[model samples]
Target: MIFRIVFLCLILLIIELYTFQVLKTLIKSKPALFSIQFISLLFLVYIVYSLMQFDRSVGQTQQMMFTMGLLLIVYVPKLILTLTLMGEDIYRLCVGSVNFFVDYDKSADFLNSRRKFVSQIGLGLAAVPFLSLIYGVTVGKYNYKVIKQRIFFPDLPDAFDGFTITQISDVHSGSFDNPEKINYAIDLVNEQNSDLILFTGDIVNTDAKEMHPWIETFNKIKKHEYGKYSVLGNHDYGEYVTWPTEAAKEDNFQAIKNLYGEIGFNLLLNEHTFIQKGEDKIALVGVENWGHNFKQAGDLSKASGQLKKEDFKILMSHDPSHWEHVVQHDDKHYHLTLSGHTHGMQFGIEIPGYFKWSLAQYVYKQWAGLYENLGRYVYVNRGFGFHAYPGRVGIMPEITVIELKKGVNVA
Candidate 1:
């Protein structure tokens, strides 16, 4: 970890230096250059100072979040500028070499002209992402949006043919810095008034104590006609933060489980429950946190223990990888699986139907939105809250409303 931090710092310094080198021509005076360098240095100081306040052993807090956010806003564009500058240099070398042989007289002019043009273009394009990140921190992070989807399943129980489920995931309460905005999001969830509320996981960033301040606020979410149910995400296991003892860690884990009840959510841990509607019933299975690279505590087999193969099932597994690796091929054939662990990498371009893409997609096959395989379906929520980064970019906080439709499998 220490080596990683040092390596990252070295990389950041390199990018900052290269960016200032390119930016020099854009601001043509020595005094202006000094001013820019001074401001950049101050930003770097603020980032380092904010970071020093938090211990590495403890979970992240709002201060660290803003610090990182500042770095992202400034440095991400610089990183892009660095890459573009390198590409221009490569182009210049190629053209200059060709000119050295073909047109020796105009070689200097051609190389310099091309270099200036590319540098101008690179600096011009850098403003786009820089401004985007600034706006993301200011307004986009709390721009809560509802995404509605309808999934058709041939075997859906008639009683639940049009069952509406409002799903939210990855609350990460510890990272929340604004009460008014969070309260507004909670109210929006209640406004949906779906038949059931399913939370995939990551209620807290690290430990159960993070939820203490927001318990009452979130508990206000109007219970749906059926009920609110949740399953644990990887972060809910209290494994990220350091504990003094194993017993203390266990105590923290137990407290988190209890907190779910305090917030009016039925926390399912490797268990199956039935949502009965007069005569017909649907199976809801929830497992503990399970991920390929993270925790592996979830027991899908045990969670679906007594359910019949024909039962209409909805499994809530925090990580989409779980759905991709296990539930999709399970003999029980879970009709739908809900997840949110990827948080869509908290950044991505997502257009309802035309396009949806994120860096998270590269890591998790079922990262966000919906996926289908052999008739089974998985909907990965983009997450209801932010973490680590403090703000969201193109991928805003999400409240997913999915309506289940009973239909013939025409496909």
Candidate 2:
């Protein structure tokens, strides 16, 4: 980890040097350039000092926030400037090579002039991402948007028609710096007044103790008519942090599971339960943490043991990769699956119904929103809270409400 950090810092430092060199043209005064560089150097030094002094045991929210701010304010803009500068350099190289070949007597002044123009253009182009990242840190992170989706299934029970299910996932409580804001998000969840509520894992970042402060706040989340159900995500297994002993890790996992119940959530681990309305019933199957490259504790066979293939099953698996690798083509057809591991990378451009994209798409095919394959559907909620990075960019925190409709559509 230390080596990785050092390597990353070295790369960022190089990029910063190059970016500031180009920026020198904009601020032609040597004193002003020196002042800006000095301030940036101070910020970088502070970041390193804070990281070294940060407390890992309690989840260092302040330190992480600072680092996130640095990334947004400094590194991200540098990245844009670097890329733009690289493109111009490539173009200049091609043009210069042609000019040298055509006329051996040409002076270097033209290339130097183009270089200045390229630097200015690069800096100008860099502002869009810089401003967008600033917005992400200040407002986008807490911008809670509720996405309501209506899913029609021929197998959906008649009694469950129009049944509303609110799903939230990846509540990385350890990263939260504002409790009041979280309380408001919970209030929004209750305001939906859905019949059932499902949480698709990642309740805490790395430790169960991190959630102690928010227990009561979460308990205040109004119960749905059918009840609230939760499943363990990869982080819930307490695998990210080191424990003194195996038993200690087990204890932490148990405490988290217990906390789920304390806050009115039916913590499901490789289990199946039925939610009934009148005489009609649908199976809600929940498995432990499961992903292609992540934890594989989820046992589909065990969770679906009591149900038949014909049952209308809703599976809650934390990582959407489970759907692509396991659930989609399984013998026991799962009508729907809910997941939230990707967090949409907490960044990306999303134009609803027109163009939706994130770097996360390259990593996970079903990173966010609804996807269907072989009549089995999965909706990957962006997330309910921030995690490693303290803030979100284009992808805001999510509150998903899925309304189940019964019927078939012919198109």
Candidate 3:
């Protein structure tokens, strides 16, 4: 732990020095420059202090969220500036080396003077994330977007063709601060009016109490014709923080599960049910939180008991890794899986139908949106709420509306 802290501090110091170089190059006013530097130092100190104050028993709190937000807002831009300046330094080194070998007079200078435009350009690039982080914390966290997806399945039940389902994931209720904004998001979910609604877990950050206040707000989500169901996410297990006792942890876990019922969802724990229409049926299977790096409570075999491989099934598994690693290969032939654990890292660029990218892709193959393998599909909702970082950037919180089409997609 001590070594990790020292390493982190060293990295911060280097980032500080490089960022300072940019400021010094751009701003000639010493007073103004010193003021900015002093403010930056204060933020650094505050971030470290706030992090130190984190209580394991208490877990996440609003202050901790603010501290995390401030840390990113302050340093992400600085890191960008640092990298940009480092690139210039590398260029300067190569030029200086070439000059030393060729011309003795030029070698006296050793290195070329830093270009003002380079510094300016670096600052310009840095401002994008700096402002973006600020906006994310202030406005983007609640910037909900309703995304519509149309997926085609050749073997889909005729009665279920064109069936619509709305999906929301990773609520992280503990991090929410704006009641009005949340209510608005709930209204948006209702506005979709899909035949079915599904919630892919992480209802609260760690404690069930975190969702208590919003229970009524979420209950506003009207009942669906096909029914509402949910499965647990890693955070719902309450394993991230220290608990007072085994009983306390277990009690918290149970309460977290009950939160789904309070919000009008059938909490499916390693079980399967059938949604029927005109004597035709499709299976709905749900499992506990199963993650490659976190929990492994989900049981595919248990969830799909008595169901045949050819049965058309829609699965609700919180983590996409469940589908990527296990479900997709299982002989049960899960036709469609819904998930939302990635939250697209709560930051990324998405241009629907054209491109989508996030840091989450490096970790989870199906980080966001739709993915398919051998006719099986998984739609990973970006998320309905923010988490550790306390905000969303380019990847706004999402409410997914998926339409099931009976025919194969041609385009």
Candidate 4:
């Protein structure tokens, strides 16, 4: 607790100090100095107010002050640096280009290039954090809801027709220090009326015990006829937290598995389950913690083991990297894979006419949402919880309701 507070204070202190330095530099401009100083003092007041945080009431306010405090600590300095450094470079480039074309100013001076310099600073200041806030509120707001959509197997038997699946990934339950918001998220999922709930890893931060208070809430979550299924995320297996020993960490993993069972989840570890939608069945395969580095423990072979050559398959692997590393190239060629680990870099944009997800560049060709290659499909969930960073920036908290509509099968 002390560390968290101090850590927050230090970064914010840096921001305060940096802002002061910026103001001090603007000493020649009385208005700039006064304005900067005034804003810094108001932020100081907020810092003082945040010191009153109590664990008892932690559930009540959503830790608004603490979250804001940390975000500002994070937001301000970066805003300053981004607005400063980025503004300077853009100013030089733009003015230099104009100078080349018009041959108006032979000078390459920073201050003398007044018009271009000021405009760059103005736009840069307004843009970065606004973009960040859009991400934060959309992703961080607990009330933000996502639904599972259903698509059928062209071969998806009539039994599973109209099967609406509620998918959640990267519910970094550890991010929340309270129950109300967590319960609210659970309630939103229940409201979806999904036939099956597939949580594609990242069940908790580092401890299964962290979820003790909300075990009741989780148990109360609504599910479709088929029930809920889950897999372990990188965070779920308890690596992020420090343990007394290796054995202790292993014990925590066992405890986590127990918690999954306790919550009524058929937690699949490198295994597959058959969703019998009549004579046509779809294989739901889940692998354990198959992510970037740490032992790619998930064997696609095991998850696809039970399938016949003609069977349709769906895979749930935590890291989207698995899509590139295993699933797409696998012999069975999974028809659809569900993953959530990317969380869309926990920030980005996707709209009707345009789709841009930064994580796609490195992780998979399709980082978030649905992507199709021939008849094969992959839908990546953007995660419902926050991690490392306290708030969401752009990638909103998601409850993806996937409606799997089957089309003509590709040979």
Candidate 5:
């Protein structure tokens, strides 16, 4: 882990030095010296911080540094927008509001234009952090904060009638130090009278202790009908933290498993169980963090062992990409799959629909909503507890209240 961190830092330091030298060579003028220096310093700090996160722990611990890094994801677009507008406004102001070339047929000096551009960029850069802070407190709160979005699966089986299932994903509990917010989330889940509670994955950030404070609230969850079930996310298996040795990391994973036991969840690691409602049978299957190109921890064949092909099935898998890539196309006739790894890119809803962009696009197509393929269905929860970013945006946190309707034709 130390070696990884040192290596990353060395690479970043080399790049930073190269960038500084290039900037020094480019800007012989004294006026723009400060801008170049400031940009170089910013790059240097970013590289240093990036290097600090290269721990053996791949989940919450590594990304924990990104609690602030995730802020960059939010502000980059805002910075671009601000810079663009500021440049245009400064251009108009300098050229007179009377529509420059068309009205007066005048061209400004190249140096003056360069100065104005740099000034605008500098102002925009400075304002980015401040604007991001303000926006994070205001609008950015929507990105990671828990907000309810009610959904009713039109064709839930009659055996699961009025089956209010509370769900949360990407908890990233490792990032939080207190239980106040977690308690509130738990209270909200309890208030819903859930027949079943499902947690998709990323339960802990990188350590089991991260969730220790919230164990009280998490254990208070009392949806006893079919009970709470969970699957491991990419974060839960000690993939992103530092330990004395590999055995120590394995112990950390076991600790998190025990934590889940305390929380009253049947943490399924590539397995299935049968839930009987009256005379009808509903099968619940859960797999580990078997995301696209991630660890192949999910084995539906093993989880579905001894189950018939025609049974009503519900799945708890971590990455929704699993649903898009594997579950939807798998030969196994799974009726419904529940997943929550996307966090909806921790961004807001889109203009036409909730289709968000950024890194989320490369993974799952139906990130935080319902999608149907042929006769199979998947519901990807946006998640409850905020992760390293510590807020919820447009997608909103979800606690689905689905009414299982009569058997629909499985055509």
Candidate 6:
């Protein structure tokens, strides 16, 4: 732990020095420069102090979230400045070497003067993420987008062909700060009026109590005709924190499970239920949190129960990695799966059907949106709440409404 701390300090120190160089190059006012440096130093100190205060026993806190936000806001732009200056330094070094060798008779200043325009350009580039991150914390976190998706399946039960399911995942309720905004998002979910609603979980960051205050706001969601169902996400397991005892952790886990029921959802735990439509029915299988890199409590075989491979099924597993690794290859042949653990890393560019990209894609193959393999499908929601950094960027919070069609998609 000490080594990690020292390594971090060294990195921060280097960033600070480079950032100071940029400020020195651009500004001539001594007072203004001193003020900026002083403020930056204070931020750095506060961030270090807040991070040091982190307690594994208690897990994530609002103060920690604030520290993370401040750290990113302060450093990301500075890192950009550092990189820009480093590039210029490389050019300067090359020129200085040539001048020293070729101009031996005359004394020329070792290197060219730092260009003001270069610093200006660097600052300009830095402002994009700086403003974007600020906006994310202040506004983008609650900016919920109801994304509509249509998936086609040849084996889809005819009666449920046009079924619409609204999926909201990774609520991370503990991170919520604005009651009015939460209510607005809830209203938006109801407005979708989909046939069924599925919450592919995270409901809280760690503790179930994190969701206590918002239970009423979430309950405001009108009952769906096809019923509300949910499966647990990794965070719902309360595994991130250190518990005083096994009993305490178990109690917290049980409470988290109850939170779903309080919000009018049928908590499906390694189980399957048939959503009947007249004489036709399709299995709705839900499993506990299972991820390639996380908890593996989910059991697909147990969830399938008596259902056969030929059954029309829709599986809800929290992490897309579960599908990427297991469900897709399972002989049961799940026709469609819904997942949302990635949250698109809560930062990415998505231009509808044209283009979508995030750092998360490198880690999880099915990071966001619909992905298909050999007639099977999985839709990864972009998440309905923020975590860690306290806000989102290009990847806004999402509420997914998916329509299941019987025929193959011609488009």
Best by lDDT: 6
Deviating ranges (above 4 Å) for candidate 3: 101-107
Q: What TM-score, computed on C-alpha atoms, does each candidate reach?
A: 0.94, 0.95, 0.97, 0.76, 0.73, 0.97
Worst 10 residues of 5 by lDDT: 108-117
Q: Mark the 10 consecutive residues where model 1 has the least summed lDDT.
A: 107-116
Q: What does candidate 3's lDDT look like per residue over 31-136, in tens digits?
A: 9999999988898888877877888898999999998898898889999999999999999988788778766456366778889999999899999999888888
How many Å off is the CA of 32 in candidate 1? 0.6
Q: Is candidate 4 or candidate 6 better by lDDT?
A: 6
Pick out the ten consecutive residues of candidate 2 with the lowest summed lDDT: 105-114
1-411, model 4: which lDDT tens digit per residue? 778777866766665554454445435688878886787667666655655454332221336535554555445544565456445557668878787667776665433333434434544674676666644654454545574444546776566666778888887665676577777888888888877888887777777766676678788876568878988888777765557789978998898888777777889998898887656667888888776655477877876776875677778888877776667877686877888887676555556337665644575566777777656778888788766556655567788887766555344
- Of candidates 3 and 1, the better by TM-score: 3
Error of 2 at 406 (Å): 0.8
Cα RMSD (angstroms) for every candidate in the order listed: 2.2, 1.9, 1.5, 6.2, 7.2, 1.5
- State the displacement of the C-alpha of residue 345, model 2, in Å, after optimal TM-score superposition: 0.7
**Candidate 4 C-alpha error for residue 317, in Å:** 0.9
Question: Model 6 — which ten-residue stretch has the worst lDDT?
Answer: 102-111
Q: What tens digits encode model 2's per-residue C-alpha lDDT throughout 83-160?
A: 877777678777777777776647754353336777888888788778887887778879999999998899888999
**Model 4: residue 154 alpha-carbon error in angstroms:** 2.9
**Residue 146, model 3: Cα distance from true site in angstroms:** 1.1
In model 1, the runs with Cα more than 4 Å from the true position are 49-54, 99-114, 409-411
* Model 1 clashes, total count: 0
How would you encode candidate 1's per-residue C-alpha lDDT over 230-260 as one tens digit per residue? 9988888888778889998899888888888
Error of 1 at 361 (Å): 1.0
